[model samples]
Target: MRRTDLSSGARTQPPSVDRAGSGKAGPALILGAALLGLGLGAYAIERIIPRRPMLRGRVIYRDGDYEIRDYPAFHALEMSLYGGREDALQRAFERVSGADRDGERPAALLDPVMQSRRSNAADGDDTGFTHGRWSVRVPLSAARAADCGFESVDPRLRVISVPAQRVAVLRFTSTEDVAFGINRVMLEDFVEDEGLEAEGPVFYAYYGLSRALPFGRQHEVLLPVSP
Candidate 1:
């Protein structure tokens, strides 16, 4: 009589079993802590980087020229597009800083100069890129009276003495969420692309209005020119 070999037919042993009961809790906790620490460290590094607000000298174009205006300039521009009577710009500033105090949002201190609103331009232009948001073009120099343009201005131009200064500028579209980390990366790229140095508080020279420019359609980046 052939005896049935039940042992042979029994299920093959699994390759491995977690009998230690050590469970994933310890390792998972450790991993999660590590990740948390890593993220915090990265954020700390980002904040620790030195960022100062430098003055961007005179800015001019074929259309017109602009001198350095005070923070009031920014407030004015913001108010124009936002509303009247109330200080909505100040409110926006508070929101941006996650604070209810002044002197927050360092980038706001840079001031707005030439506000040029561009219609949607396709391809590289990417105008009206970030809704109808404005794109700024500020000039930089040793002094306001100093030469700010590419070179000598044409006969049709006039050089006016404005508040001259140095600055680290950036051009970015508006966002419901501002990601400093990504901004830092893009800032590095922009500096390299422009052959300029990164001396940044990250200023935006808003050209037009925000509602006009759509996503990836607006054109703005930090300008890291020589001091």
Candidate 2:
């Protein structure tokens, strides 16, 4: 299976092993061992790594990995990705970390960076995406944006205030494109079943750093809903 490095937004494939020898017992044993290893690794990562604070929100409803959350208006650094996804992510990170601003204090990192597709009007297919947008919540008040001392170097980058919203979210693991597509379908179905009116396009929320293994990583599909 392939996994993403959340820090860099890079995909990595795990090493494959040959199971030709030792009969059917070999494959079963390998599977069991892999499961055990993953379990142990997840536990270790949880215990050893200090997690970053996630954007605060109140959960008003919950069903398995699905939830309706009420989030307060917050400030976020956002940029449109017209180029490669990886390159855009790296540039955003550099700006967030103050690597671009010499001698300045880096902004506090937050969990669950949000990304959404930017559809071209010419594209007939709703599922077709031309580019994307990436946004990361910053520890700053929307009321006092100027005090934050954050400035955008790229024309596409800007600091914006996201209004308070009621959102329906579907939580899942794995960074695979198929996983995202599947969850989006499930989330849309859930919204329809609940009779909720979707107010915006579907966006993805990615949590934690790349140090987290694929099994332990967290991803969410979120859609704004009418109150």
Candidate 3:
């Protein structure tokens, strides 16, 4: 796929991975093993890690239907994804979450972008791969997140309200990167368990980074409430 790495600072093209030429042994095996180990290591770190207080927050705005919570680090995390792709959101979660295998949900974390649709069917973007748009709005009083903790509010805790509604939420553990998949599994389980029909994509928010020191990141997956 033609793409650029927009994870870090500026966007840059990444070297393509050639599948055919990778059949060679020696270095290929080593590289593959190295990558496997790296993935496993990340999983391990997230599983065993503890949590820590990152910030306290509350909902600041309601977008006709949805509420927005403002966190100090929200901008840094949201902007990491060039597009609102679920894969990108998962990676961002993993990067920010400081947990190990024991407490990480690899799915459920999602980019809150508006899904864009083709104006005409002939546009040929029918794959629906990039159909959704990712977006976030800062609350008017978002800067007060830090103050909430001083008034006895736990910095590690947060709340979001869309008004006049409640949602069924599913929880799990994972560094943000893979939270989406885990969330998906959990959501499916919830749906089957409760026999509730879904009207659309799930709703949610990223709460404290972690309960442990540096490296801990946490968030929640929320489903929209139906009347």
Best by lDDT: 2
- Compare the candidates by TM-score and give the number of the best one: 2
1 against 3, candidate with superior TM-score: 3
**Each model's C-alpha lDDT?**
0.36, 0.69, 0.41
Range of the 10 consecutive residues with the lowest summed lDDT in candidate 2? 121-130
lDDT of 3 at 42: 65
TM-score, candidate number 1: 0.26
Error of 2 at 62 (Å): 0.7
Kindly list the per-residue Cα lDDT of model 1 for residues 1-227, writing each as its tens digit. 13355778854554554446568679989999999997777566546643323433344221112121222111211212232101333333333223212242223222233333333333463322334332223322233224233223223223333322343334445542244235545655655664656443344343322222222322233433454
What residue runs in model 2 are displaced by over 4 Å at the alpha carbon?
1-49, 83-95, 98-107, 121-146, 152-155, 210-215
Better of 1 and 3 by lDDT: 3
**Cα displacement (Å) at residue 60, model 1:** 28
The lDDT, on a scale of 0 to 1, for candidate 1 is 0.36
